[model samples]
Target chain A: MFQDFKSDPFMFCIVIGVILFVIAQSLFFLIRAVKRAKALGISNEKIKNTISSSAVFSIAPAISIAVTVLVLSVALGYVLPWIRLSVIGAISYEVPAAENAIEAAGLSSGIGADITDPKIFTAVAWVMSLGCILPLILIPLILKKIQKKVTGAVNKNAKWADIMAAAAFIGLICAFLGRGIAGTGELATNDAGEKINVTIGDGAGILSLAAIVSSILFMLALTLLNKKLQWKWLEAFSMPVAMILSMAVVVLISHFAPGLAAIEWRY
Target chain B: MMKKNRSYIDSVHFYGRIWCLLALCVMLLVPTLMSLHLKAWPDLGIVGKAFAATAVLFYPTAVVEVIAYAPLLGAGGTYLSFLTGNIVNLKLPCALNAMENVKVKANSEEGEVISTISIAASAIVTTLIIAVFVLIFAFNPKFTALMQSDTLAPAFKQVTYSIFGAIAATYFVKHWKLAIFPLAMVSLLLVFFGSIPIGILIFVGVIISLLGAQAMYKLKWV
Candidate 1:
């Protein structure tokens, strides 16, 4: 029963249904927003550019998300991960939540660890779903109020508002950068309770750090090229292109310098 | 005319609420239907333990995210983004870039619409891409191997680093005054704490940046 449930056609259909619903919701909003843009006197050309650029910008991240789905599917099965990553599930949140649920159920946690028990599977599913439900619930209940306060504060002073917005974005970006850099040399414990040294100077950590730096450099290069070559079109798709190129760099570096890709210090 | 524009936003909230409520019901149904079909329910005890484990960490961050992201995303974009997820990685960046490209202030009506449109586009594309990828590689062993391969693992692991680095370099160069203090503070906190959740750091960053901006304004530093 457990094995039958893992790759069940019905389960896949349900996941597909959820994805379709999201797509429908997206289309509904897209059409309405485009109409609003038109009513507000935004030109057809600008609107079209926004749509095309956003779609282009999304491809790299979307593929990355697909990688997450593939990662989570090994443990939770394809349907659940597909459903989760598609709707409101961050890879950061899903994996840890799934592991916590598995451990709580008195099961060894990892991919392919006999998670086919119906109760175990159900527990993992519920935990993953319920854990992330707060955002969905809270946003609907309080978003208007939140927006009103935020807009009100910003409206009080135009210059200050501009500064605030820029600051908030900077803060968010800085936090992510800090976290990424900090993780470069952190110690990670595996399921066997062995400590592994993850160093950025000459291991997978280094490759990860190099990807970050390379992406930044790539963006700079794109900026220079856009200026030097007089090609304004490159500006719209530069970030995504840079990101994909950086990932490709990781692949290349790992192939040529395998020792720097990953080195486990078993202790 | 102002009244008409206001009504448009109002109607968006009205419709957004309905859609969000419906999405919630649909999301909840997944677990319910699964349990019924499998004829297996999670033990309440284990469910409680699991929920506590995750909620203790995530709930506060969820609250912070709503507050931090609402102003940037606006109402319509916020609704769709929070519902569809991937706000920080995919949707937020897409919306920001679109708004920047179109030269609209995020506080204005035009900004709101542009944000909504861009987020909607991004959500659609991401959904389509995921659907296509899943269809192609869902059960394929070779594809799975490629995904889990050591050579590719570093690339996948560093995706967030690459993305954030590019974003930071762009924004920091553009807004160095606002960028300097928060970047320093957050980096320090990360060094000290080892692993702070992005939500908490964002909240802290907002407060610090606000203070920093206010100080610079008072000092006539622009």
Candidate 2:
């Protein structure tokens, strides 16, 4: 009765409807925010700058996210991944969640697995949707309380408030940076089934580290150019430009200099 | 201006809640309808096990994120960002850039408005891009092949690192004093202990950085 459900038109229609709903939500907020910005006396130029730069900044990351959708679609079908990635699903979280769901269901866990079985597919959808549901639930319940306390604390000491914000951002950066660095080491299995790693710096870890360094360099160079050339407009595009260029460079290096690329471990 | 701002925020909360609740219902129905149509309800036990595996880790992280990101995102921005997703990677960065460009601080009303504008723009653009790609490329073998091509794999893999690295560099350089201790401590942990979950590391870094900054402030170093 449920055969051909994976690529069914009904499934695609549901996914498309969800996507459109999200788009409408985005537009609602966008129109409201723009009006508020105007009421707040922000210049049209500044508002335009914010919108254009943000739209520019989002392109590379959105493309990367699309790539994720494409990869997941191969296994889960286009409808589910498209809906998942467009909504609360992230690349890092969705892949693992799907694999775990498949494993828990005693199904083969990988892209090549036959996931067309309706029961198996239903289980996956349920698991994936339920897994990330907490944030949606929590945000509505506690966000206002949290914001009130945070705003009160910050308002008490404006100077330290800036420091607090800066520190939080720094902490986030350090976490990502630390992870990138840690990924560079080599791992080996021991007799006790424990994995040991040597810091050889020739894997995805090192490649990621290199990408970070190259992107930073590109940003610094852009900063210098902006200063010397008085090209203020470049400031908005600097981060995205640096990101795209750095990724392009790494891709070229990986293709031409295989040794420089992160080694893919095969079991 | 203050009264106007407060009322606007209140209205945002009112509308935001309704929109999010509706979105949540739509999300739930995706699976519910599929099950009804296919007549294949999943094993509840299996679903529970899978949910536990992911939720145990993610639930706490989600709580932490709302706390960590609310100030930066403000009222309207926070509601929209949480609903639209991609907070750290896309929304936060867009808001940061907008605030920086507009010369507004997050604590100020101006900052809140600018953040909302930027995040809303980002959400719109991201959704449109995804929609276009899904419609245009989902059925095309050539597009799928190109996306999965060996030559482009490294670029895709490094995209997150490059994006975050550039952002980190910009902010770290600006607040080097506040950044040093946390960066050093986190780097040490990574070096010695392999990899720590970002969720935990963020709190560790925040606490250390806050303490360090406070100490420096008391010492009149800034």
Candidate 3:
């Protein structure tokens, strides 16, 4: 059973999931930076520069993730057998036997069977998993080096980078909420003996539209409340966060709900 | 003006033309590797086939092809196109490196933005040119059949268009915020429909985006 998981193409899931996790944290940092800009009431040009710089900075990890995934994807195609043996193995007892063998090999720990079992399903899941900060921890130090080289000792563009980071956070969140469902849905099974089609189709279109509308409204609101929001970065981040949260809620509700219940939250 | 042009040429040195050259060598080697692999395992697994296909598309040869001919086609336009297509999904690092290059020459914030925009424009134009070439060269039955065979045409077309789509997307995302939606839609449609070669789709999209950008200029949308 554990070997099945290791051999399955789903192994790539762990790698991609870790990448998404990094993306999520990066967005949070971006939000904080945007809030800072809103408090200061920076100029649009300045805001844009900040956003663009931070965007550039944030893009590094995202690119690394994409490149790593692409390379891994290529590696998968090159080394792995394309035709899945899952169907045959599912009906056979070989899967469970293999699982037991692996567990026996791992019994040296002398722990409980559940814990000692290498087939616990979580071992292979953790193989490609870099710790949470593995991807993101280098970003600030990298940015600082880049900043020193670009703007010199003064760190002139640091503020602008902060603002840009906020915008990136918003973009990252939007991507996460939009694609995360699809990603998770790939693993989703139809317990009811139905065909598992993960695509949300034109249904999610309505949620996307609402997200856009609410975001625009939120941005306008933030602009109007600019002075009250105090922090320019906070004001900048609010519209995007509001939009992201709204979309995330819509997607999560739709995904978790049953078919009939899912349709209810579509709009 | 002459002196400024000369200075611009000088600055290309700072852009790490060496890395660009390395990318070129990789493009050339990819096809050879693919052919060798194909000979070794004609019926490799699905993953294997995917790798081979990706090699054809993203190989350093493609990069080299763009860098070598893009400038020769007109100026640095094609080189930028190749660069843009190669880095489309990976924008941040590309942009930051580009920003560093701009900062080397630009003294003011406005100058930095302008330089960045100009590089972007040139990149788009170059990619458009390559897309046109690939589409016409690969998709046209006459061209494909004459060079290789009819069956080879589809493979050629796929890679050509992939590059075209990638470059067009990069350009669209940089200029107008709204441009991304339509460009993305068109790209999806093109990919799904296997419509005319990627170049033709991108050519059409580029024209439309240009018109839109011009209209925005007229309406002060920028």
DockQ each candidate and list the results. Answer: 0.63, 0.62, 0.03
Q: Across residues B95-196, which tens digit of lDDT does each residue of candidate 2 receive? A: 887898788988787888888888888888998898777766766779867776767766776676787788877887888887778778877876666545
TM-score of chain B of 1: 0.90
lDDT (tens digit, per residue) of candidate 3 on A1-267 = 223322233433332332233233223323432343345453455545445432332222222222222122221221111111100011012122222322333422211123322222222111111111111222212322332343441256543332332222223222222221111122113544343545432222333333334434544454456667576554423322333344344344344543532331221
For the candidates in turn, chain A alone yields TM-scores of 0.87, 0.87, 0.31
Deviating ranges (above 4 Å) for candidate 3: A1-204, A214-230, A235-247, A255-267, B1-10, B13-16, B27-206, B212-222
Listed per prediction, chain B TM-scores read 0.90, 0.90, 0.30
Docking class of 2: medium
For every model shown, what is its TM-score relative to the native structure? Answer: 0.92, 0.91, 0.34
B-chain TM-score, candidate 3:
0.30
- What lDDT does candidate 3 reach at residue A92? 13
Q: Stretches of candidate 2 above 4 Å error?
A: A1-4, A110-112, A184-204, A263-267, B1-6
Estimate every model's Cα lDDT from 0 to 1: 0.79, 0.78, 0.30
Q: Residues A1-267, candidate 2, lDDT per residue (tens digit)?
A: 113577588887787788788878878887888898899899888889888998988988887788878767767877788788888778667877887788788865454455867887888899889887777788789877877787798879888778878887777777767666653333544455455764333233557777889988998888788889988788777888888888888878877876757453211
Q: Give lDDT tens digits, candidate 3, residues B1-222.
A: 754564332332223243234334333233223334333212223224333333333243333333222211211222232323332222222333233322322322332332333334323332233333333432354652343332222122122122222222223234335354334544444334432322233334434444544454456555
lDDT of 1 by residue, A194-264 (tens): 54654533222566567878988998888789889987677777777788898889889888988866642
What is the lDDT for B221 in model 2? 69
